[model samples]
Target: MAICIPPLDASTESSAERKLHEALRSGLSDDFLVLHSVKWIAKPRGAGPRDGEVDFLICHPKHGLLVVEVKGGGVILDYAMRRFASIDRHGDEHEITNPFEQAMRGKFAILEKLKESPFWQKLGLGRIPLGHAAFFPDVDGVGGLVGPDAPLDIIGGRQDIALISQWVDRAFTYWAGPGGQGALSELGAGGVATVQRILARVSTTRPLVSARLVQEEQTRIELTERQAAILDLLSRQRRVMVAGGAGTGKTLIAREKAARAAEEGLKTLLVCYNRGLADHLREQCEGIEGLDVATFHQLCKRWIDKAKSELGRDLMAEARRDYPGGTEFDHHQPIALAFAIDAFGPNYDAIIVDEAQDFGDEFWLPIEMMLSDHADGLLYVFLDENQNIYGRSAAIPIKGEPMLLDKNCRNTTTIHAAAYRYYRGVRIEAPEITGTKIELLTAPDIDRQARAISALVTRLVAVEGVAPHDIGVLLCDGRARSSFERALAAMTIPKSSRWGHLEGYGQGSITVDSVAKFKGLERAIIILWGLDASDPVVDRETLYVGMSRAKSMLYLCGTVAACGRVLDAGVA
Candidate 1:
């Protein structure tokens, strides 16, 4: 684990030292312990200038201890006089502090500190070996230092950096002897352990996080730096509304804020309009305590279930009798809301609603009433009015101006440009493209569309190298799910694939979800099917939702008329 002692003095570090620090950090393994820009106290308190700074003190189990002093400017070495001088960019030479001498002083100070430290003093290190070197990152050459008097072995430029491990090995052999036949042979393994304990006195600047953990974190949907900053700002407010275009990471920010609230011991509820999105959030927040994830209807159901015992009436039974089995809950939401409010009031510390644009003004009232009375009670809503395919045009029920997130980090520039042109009236910041242009495919009928989509998926897997889970096939019309399934069956794709009607696939399975279901989620590549511009207004929003789901690549498949609506701004 890397460590820092007494923090860093930025003013004291030359440009060369900074560059060398970054180089060593990137080159070295995590197993090595490093302390950089450190102040080593030479003596007991007030005994002259005690603070002696060193550029870096690196420690490893096999390499023992290494101290490095960095110099940035050009250097002139006099072999006869054994003097070192610094040369500036203007070719003027100036006498500078000898790096070797500085390293030695810092080394002495470090040893003294180790001996004085109670933790290290107990180790009882006896004559532990240490290596010191001078690094010149800016200097390309050293002149006048030749023959036996030259300290070529101790001084190094950039070219010599690759041989540092060999140098450390030589130092270990010289001071401790080769193999088990070293100077500390009598002390054995115990003495080496003590020396390591001495060098480990420096404090770590940050906790050790594994590379795998970092990689996993990177794989998860991430917010841009600006979006993260806005999230931070929202945390400080009592109520907030965030509005962003597709791929702007609004849902990611909502989940993050909900997770943070749970971490802070708040009773948090994360709600979204899409059932698939709610399930996704629930899975993402699996182990988080005091955090509940559910769709708006699911949340209302829970409240209704609670009211059954208190009101001494089966509210769900009444709803079922009225709305019947296959009825959508959007029309019954107000009834559920009334029942929920009468049953429970203000039980949660924070309420975060995602896909808020899909909710009517009244849908938020019961949710707002669920917040606790504390001043810090939070009600954060994230939305994108442009993607409001559900036709909820009422004003949102919340206070304060919504913070706008214009950056689209999810899609490549090409796909985002197409989506922007489709919705030209809305404000959308152009995204930085790092992938291929969107592929618009035409098929005369559903049969040909299916074949084309299957081929695209095949090429994406074989040629583009995208993983199965990273790919998605979106169908807007529910009726097209079976046709695509039959076409995919004809292609004999793996049985591991999942349709939206089935249970959760979790990960590692290609998903086929409707555009409405796939909202608030994204994939590396997308194959959009079943968009027909016969109803241009409906098809535009649906097609927009499908195309925006692709982060890197988008393969659009439909009749020529449907694909044309996507290219032209035909939907209002």
Candidate 2:
């Protein structure tokens, strides 16, 4: 088979080594699979190389496995000590680990890895033939070769790549065992298939560096000219309402303005409707002095606590009366806002609110109470009415006319087209950008939906090469969280929840959250799981928020009936 080299960055590799690698890639027959920079996690121990990085692992159907260690520069072999060194251009000798020993440890690590993977054991591939080789591309292989015991047959220069290939074939010609089973010659068709399967499983490849993803993240956070102009005007104008549809950079603008306010030595309080969105904003604005980030309820709770002593009224009792048997602090937001308007207020130089659509009329009175006395002190509001999932469509009580941010800087054109259907009344702009089309997956039940989600996650990670954090699996409501969790567990795909503080969640782990919880947050790839079309109005609003959360890729997963309703709602 044609040689297949895994993704690698040639910048860190030596010129000679790169040249040799290219030659091998071109020269090897279709039977060989050459993988570079393969990684395997091994338990930490005092022994050799602790099973981390392997330079190269070559697998062939007929030849079995070969672990090759490539070295650059003039390789010097010590005849007496039997050690290895490389001489630099200035004639400096740098002692190096023996390539043969390094390759042998890597071989052992691979064996250990295979032992741990139950998938490999099920394949029935027994004893796998293993070989080791040290490649020195700068060393002369054609003439003046090292004497016997020098491993000249395996240790060769660029000229002997074909010779090395021949040596590999010869090495495995007489080798016995399938892996842990009988001899290679005694293996049947099934056993041979098992060998192929095992080889494929052990081969893992990722680029040494992903410059494209880095650049994409940078560009995403950077503001466009129009957005900058609006931000500039809003920053200077002080008190104004900013209106925009999903992906219009409303959240980002709010954040920038808040950051600027804090930088100007003004005490700022940045608030949002959703607790999750508040937490996200807090994380983004971390380390900015003179800034306090909190949810609307959180802000209300602070004032409510103070109002107890000043108002001479039991605010908790009043809140319970307003929302009977409610345990959450949000249930008291209206009562607290009313209390603040009547009895308590703390002046903040700047108060910025995001996800303003989720707030009710009572919220604005308290916001007004906290406004600073100075003219430059700002109170900015950002809203996208279509995203108001709670059906609270109250107008933001701001003095000046709302500045409209029409251009969307987040989602790609394809994604925007799919999301814009639900936002019909808004002037959603679509730039000439290309991206994956919105995908709608229909399943019979939760089980099938889980399977579909699992498969999609694998494809996005392995095929499209998207990072796990960039991918989010969002549920329509918290009740569906268990079903998605069950699906993920059934598929054996480990994922982190976005519900709590998530202290120990690794950045590379896939995130699971409700669509409502993920409002004001953006991911590169989003899978909206367990959409309920029973209430078309509610479902439409929820899906509108979830669909726009994906910056580039969007996957809608639900039952056939639910999907039909979504399609009827004009969102695909």
Candidate 3:
């Protein structure tokens, strides 16, 4: 048996360790770099512990600072004193992995690999002053990496944890160089370049994702600088959260993220608010291989169904029975149930949530429950608090920071800027496609609105080259069906009706759809007809979501006043 194990609370200590790292980053005269949460699976053939991820690797210039394993986790492990260390590894397999030892071996391997890399000297982030430590920040007064009777420091007035940390800092100071000055600039030039090359190779050969946008008629649809930056940020972070206004491409980013996960050999789930978006996502992700996208409720229902099927009960009956009706519920209840049961049912390696602000408190509880303690799954969230009409989500749920996606990609920057003018507080993210313009039309009634919309759709597809499938129309409630169909019939545009179905729209089914049901998909030319300026909810925002759907052109068909409202809303 080992006399003492490494610190077991590395992750918990991450907060404090992070503070120290940030301090080092700010105070260090030279780079004593800490590589965060780098997974180091045992190479195909190697010595030492074969599989695990490294929390941090301290890179000094000359002498190697150790690769440290941080454990935010507290509580000591005394295996010799106790026999209750049995760990369930699933499927009847039982094993015990001491976190300390695990961390130690990981440190050794990372240091060894860094020492042997080709770019160790050229790119500048060299591996000379390298060392490793397992920090437990929560144990403020704690010292050493052991437990209660095992002789570990506990947080208290008597504990000398700060002194111990200072000692560790001094102990590992040699990693920053002979005198610990950490001037390995020459070394970094080479090491940084080499690490980049190596990572590039690994990514090319065995990537964490394989991604591409599925666009047949969106040649003009270009990703803005902000969109590209968001993608870049997504590439670096293990957990990414995107918060943007409506028509800000949150769902699109979520889809793109799914594609990236698939490219990286990870299974991904694209979760949305309702079946409309869910079904739309399902259809869109059809050609993207290895992507397992679905609605959260749908996926949860599937899980509950699978679990319940084994117990011999009708899953649908049970799920719907809770509502005493069908489909819609208190909204929070289904979400709560999904979050609860599937908390441990991640079922996949990566997850992306869209319309996140619509989710409730207990929603994430299920996700947390489903995650394995040491699992390397990536969690990404996409949401916009401004779009949260229901007051459901909180900023930074699960402690994730929001990455602002202010560039609007769905509309011409001009039209997107318009919504911001109406709701001036909103920040509009610009699109890469610059020439597209917003057109507003004044109509006496539905007849004129339909005529204007039909004319706009025809011009966009025929004159501008936008695909028929990429053009869509959003009609406000009442007489919209007859108005849209009559206009389209006059033009001989073939259409289908989703009139009664729960998710009532399709790719090429028809030109006109309800604003609520057309949540997940997008088109190049979007016409919103019959927008009622009088309705409280159908104001700037209601149309904002509708207008942002068009990639090239937007046509608003409404009363003269409503038309003016739309036109004024477009000019931010």
lDDT of each: 0.66, 0.66, 0.53
lDDT of 1 by residue, 240-335 (tens): 888888878787778777876665446789998887777767877788888999988888777877777677667656656676642446545546
Where does model 1 exceed 4 Å of error? 1-222, 309-311, 316-328, 331-333, 374-376, 424-426, 462-465, 494-502, 506-508, 534-538, 568-572
- The 10 consecutive residues of candidate 3 with the worst lDDT sum are 203-212
lDDT of 3: 0.53
Off by over 4 Å in 2: 1-217, 306-314, 318-331, 337-345, 374-377, 462-464, 494-506, 532-538, 560-572
* lDDT (Cα, tens digit) per residue for candidate 3, span 446-484: 666666666665565557654455556776553456655
Q: Which ten residues in a row have the lowest lDDT in candidate 2?
A: 203-212
**Cα lDDT tens digits for candidate 2, 103-174:** 778878766655544444556666666766667677665234353533444455666765656655544543
lDDT of 2 at 98: 72
How does model 1 score by TM-score?
A: 0.59
Predictions ranked by TM-score, top down?
1, 3, 2
